[model samples]
Target: MELFGQSGNFVLINIVSGNIDFDLRDDNPAPCENIWVGNSSTAPTDGECI
Candidate 1:
């Protein structure tokens, strides 16, 4: 489905691992900053964005 945020737009799909794979795009594309997304049950320890 289409996902919109303050950063940009994205398309997310479900994966076998019960995780979402998102393809993000932006008008002014640049390196993503501190973005992290994952299942709440298993989050990043270092606060690093995936």
Candidate 2:
């Protein structure tokens, strides 16, 4: 997942909360932008990527 001018590459696992956490990576790279990933059940108030 490569976002424009942003690195969205990473694996998500053992996620217990809606916070951002990555367990593996090629390097401790800079985080991606404040992007948003929402579903149909997602609310607008929950803002930012979760």
Residue lDDT tens for model 2, 1-50: 33344444333432333334432212323454433333232212231233
User: Residue 30 in model 2: shift from native, Å?
Assistant: 20
Instruction: In angstroms, give how far residue 29 of model 1 lies from its true place.
Output: 1.8
lDDT of each: 0.31, 0.33
Per-prediction TM-score? 0.18, 0.17
Q: lDDT per residue, candidate 1, 1-50, as tens digits?
A: 21234443332342223334333222332354424344232321222133
Give the Cα error of residue 3 in candidate 2, in Å.
6.0
Where is model 2 more than 4 Å wrong at Cα? 1-4, 18-50
Residue 6 local lDDT, model 2: 45
For model 1, what is the C-alpha lDDT against the true structure? 0.31
Error of 2 at 15 (Å): 1.0
